[model samples]
Target chain A: MDFQPTEERRMLADMIGKFIQNDYPMKARLTAGTSALGYCPEAYSKMAQLGLIGALFDEEVGGFGGSGFDIATVFTELGKGLVVEPLNDTAMTSGYILAHTDQLELVEQIILGQKRVALGLIENGADYDWSAPETLAHQTGSGWQLSGMKTCMKFAHGADALIVSAQTQSAPGISLFLIEAAAAGLSEHSFQTVDGGNACEITLHNTPAQLLGAEGAAYPLIDAAAARATLAVCAEALGVMERIKDMTIDYMRTRKQFGSVLGKFQALQHRVAQMLLEIEQAQSAVINAANDLQSPTDERNRAISAAKYSIGRIGCAVAEEAIQLHGGIGMTWEYDLGHFAKRLVMIDHEWGDQDFHLIRFSES
Target chain B: MDLNFTEADQAFRQEVIEFLNAELPADISRRVHADLHVSKEDTEFWHAVLHKRGWLTFNWPKSFGGVGWSPVQQFIFEEECAAAGAPRILPFGLKMLAPVLMAFGSKEQQEHWLPRMCDGTDWWCQGYSEPGSGSDLASLKTTAVKQGDHYVINGQKTWTTLGQHANMIFCLVRTNSECKPQAGISFILVDLATPGIEMRPIRTLDGGQEVNEVFFTDVRVPASNLVGEENKGWTYAKYLLAHERNGIANVGISGQKLARLKRLSLSQKRRGKPLADDPLFAARLARLEIELRNLETTNLRVLDEFSKGAGPGPESSMLKIIGSELEQNFDDLTRRALGRQAQAHMPEVFEPGYNGPQVAPQDMANQSAAYFNKRKVSIYGGSNEIQKNIITKMILGL
Candidate 1:
């Protein structure tokens, strides 16, 4: 299959890449390290205003480009910027659901970056078993009551709403619900992730909710959505990996040991080469998955699992090797390698860890 | 965006499959499929068949008597051959030397060598690696000094694979000693029948004489035998090495081996259970399969670029690195599948008709030898270490 993006997509990439280079520098990235919202809110709006949120959706849903490569292109640029905002939570998951739920009003707000949304899918000890969600949703007339705890509800700290997946005690399967951040009986304790973003342990006690899709049949949607999230994170991780590699290579070229650059040594060169092969392998998997997005469910799952497995393993490798190759300076906070490395490792752990994806790959 | 082949491509694939099934001798196919020893006559016979069909030098351009297939067509032909268990087209003559000749050889040299190379009259061997020059190949010490009308060549070349079957050799000789290491070299074609030359078999770790050592003591060669200018062998040598590297990423061969490994593992038992059923083994098998797919895609990408005449810059080295490593992995797994049977390295069992050793089945007995031979895949082609250096220089600019 052709790997080259179309002219339109390339222009989109160029714009986004230039934006990251011109606006989102190390200072901008580091400023969000301790911010109250854990990111630059103005920058978030600027990203949405630049059509990133819309670029990931369709014209029917207030945007233009929504292909797999389109999403990959956007995330790759975001990854290079080390953009602290959670696009996986806000756009890929919540925005996806809102677009599919026939909620054009909410989709318009999201595309305008006037509001934010997060998906509450993770539980503390669920171990990535998304199909068997523990959050309960009970029907009350036309509305529903959601009562459960979602751990690490990314971007929910200051979001307009949360797209929560819950099991129905009466219907016997999981369903998707749109719950407002101000919904009654809902509480959260927000905390910072190691990678410089905010997430919360959200507890909902019969929180009023609006159904987003078919009741008791949201498992497929949840699976597909989570798979998309995994794909997005992988693309982002690849972007971060390239940046780290460039920084490490620069250090190797300039840094001297025994009156020669460290890069002249065969050992470090081999390590870098190994890192590149892993990155290529991981990239091939993501591209494969991206193309398979419109294929059958089995095909999609197989590709997604393979991509996640490769990215998780390789992302961790580039992360650890980028630091070790940089020597003592690699570990210090002032160096951006540590930050990007942190993002890489955290990305690996977020969707599915290496071991999890390896076994899942076998099963898939 | 489109992966499907055109109607013509599909027809070509079918034609290739049908021809292979009809013309490939079963005995040679059986030997290749099982990694069993095949006689030189068998290889020559298959070579002659392809030569007659004008498909022997598949890598060359149509102007040089090649089939002129597209990169995709070349890939399809190779994959089908590997799948059909056809013996590999020996690289020394067709894949390696022919390209160099087509590029830089004089008109007389091309007319004399290319035809013979295609018709199986000239079995060729490469004389690049010396006793002290492998990865540091530029420092090769093989010397050739010009006399009145001839050049006297003297030095030793090691690891000349299948040299015993070769009647011709392409060598890198140091024609100028005062210049830099790479600048002083020259490429020369030598006839095996020349005086002052001797060949001796070097038994490899697998107890096979597939390689040899050739020593020269003032071997006289006509000065006109030089392919290009004096002190320019390094350029042609590098060109040939790039071609060799492209073949090292043997995706089709490895894919066939993977299929065989899975089949054998399923039939073979480990601790009273089928090895394929073991989770640990299965996971590794699946992982290997996944990496193979990745490499296949990567190869396609490289070929796509090459089809556009980019000719696989630094990426060939990456393929060489991974392709060799992947082969070793497959060999290691094959040995593991053999379990204790791999310990029996009876050389007689490797003899074509020897059925004496019954402790291990013939196919199982083949694993250790194949594994040992595959160990050199990474070491021989400039070594994976050198490949990594190439990658760093090309991709990382370091």
Candidate 2:
């Protein structure tokens, strides 16, 4: 039950942190977020070249054979950069799901940066039901056919393939299918997320799909993928928290109000101190959840729920407080503080909102 | 960095758990779970039980009649006790003053007082906070003028927790006026029954008489009662304060309260479902649990450092800050879980044989009382604001 990151993991985190700080600053994210694809494919290719996309899988599956902590390290750095990329959705979630299947060729393509995939888990009006899919899949004479709409398909425009969840007619159970973007009867309507990332409402009308695993066995796979996605979001939230703390401290030091720096005021100081404490708590939860990712079933589920619940609750509070403490400038789109807050709010509600995660955690 | 308990530690944990299950009286445990103030008889009964088990002075050295458990073992013992609803040991003697006495007192002082403290024969209260000198404790104005062979003490001490129940008090008194405020102070041990001393209970927001205001009008005390040098009381006071601040962390107590909150939340219904099923409340509870976990780990780290023979320094300030906030937050959540029930009861219900006001339910009669009582956590053992200042100066060098 060691919660501390390994020394190598720490080094990896530091390296990623430096890379994000030097290469993908807020301006870069702002520029990329406004792009047609919502993220820089060139930057993502660079990340793939650095072997960060396949951090949590085996070398045989075209990965670095790193543990969940390694992936968390990368995601946390990406979060600090407020990177408007689908690294979390594609690399962590879809990549993890692909690695577990027998599709080595597809996994290798994703690992080699030749192809990208985005997870389409949240269907329209789904409302936090990860297992109760609104989309339906039917086994056809040719292969499988998917028909429904998945809203908030993250980075959908950039992804060459989509790993989606649908209920099959035979078992009426949620299953996952990998569908190519150019398949017949596939359409995407792209829009901007609150954080300036590209999200799409993907409509599938008898879209040709390949079953990733055994029929109706993909629920657990999707669950694991969702857990991975949650931890990645938590890591990113922590990154934003760290930035807020640093920025708040910097503002306190320089921005004087009433003949003294705001940091000198006990009220503001206590508020910042509280923000640090919440971030630390969330950090512990994320590390614990990441460590439990491959552990026994019950413990893994408990840790994941606990992590998501803790992060969703504290992350949103910290983000909101960060904006409030920054005063009027924080509300403007021109300010980076609002950008981080927006990302935090979006990520907080992505896998499950605080309320949704809390119910799952308590029931578990 | 590992949180896993060793097999031996687990066995020790089981032993403690078993003892608590077998030995703790059901009524006492119920009172503890209910957050009701335990009777003096119940407190003494548990104290005797622990004393017989040779665990009364859990933090004392073996040579001083203690279990002499390792730091982790002590942590486990405290945690298990709190979790099992055991009454908290009065710490003015055992946890706070004993360490200072061990470090600075004469051998005779240790021999005369340590055994009594271990046997729970002497209940001690602290006389540090005065009307004007709480956060700035060294500025206390209580004076002890040296008379023939004794010091005549005069001045008042307010917010003396449990002082009305104490037979003795350890105090910080001004002995020399020329030196700095801290340098002019001397640590004095005074008998509460002294002729010129008077104690008046101060009713707190908590609706309990846990603290008192003690007035001294030329209370005479033998010069021998002085623990260390006459004008060096500030150093001893600081030492005592470090211990107080560390105990003020109260992670074990907070952890127990968190568990109780969970049970209450599970049983209580909100919006046609258990409060535990309410996503908002559940998220809040989970966040508290995570914070408590981090606090527990940080506390263990501090304990590990202490076991290496290093006393708590300014880092204890950090513990105080985090611990008090967490405790307050837990109480707030509990109150939130209690909902309107938290405000339904009057303070009089906590008194003996009240039965005057008809409350919502038997369980909720004390909810407001508990909430009011917990409000003092941030104010006592030095305010958390003071703790932050200490951290800022010590760690941040601001």
Top lDDT hit: 1
lDDT of model number 2: 0.77
Report DockQ per prediction, comma-separated: 0.01, 0.01
* Tens digits of per-residue lDDT for model 2, B1-398: 67887898899999999999989987688678767877777888898999989888877878787787887888888888988889988888888889888989999999999889877779899999886566567778899999999999999998887887799999999999888787899999999999999999775533356778899999999999999898998888777767753345678888888888877776765545677987688888999999999998898888778878886688788888788779878865775565423333333444556654332234444654464455566667766667778788878999
User: What TM-score does chain B alone reach in each candidate, compared with the true chain B?
Assistant: 0.95, 0.94
Provide the lDDT at B38 for model 1.
Answer: 61
lDDT of 1 by residue, A318-363 (tens): 8756765664345445557777876776675566655557777788
What is the overall TM-score of model 1 with all chains considered together? 0.53
Q: What is the interface RMSD of candidate 2, in Å?
A: 17.6
Residue pairs whose backbone atoms clash in candidate 1: none
**Docking quality band of candidate 1, CAPRI definitions:** incorrect
TM-score of chain A of 1: 0.97
CAPRI-style grade of the A/B interface in model 2: incorrect
lDDT of 1: 0.78
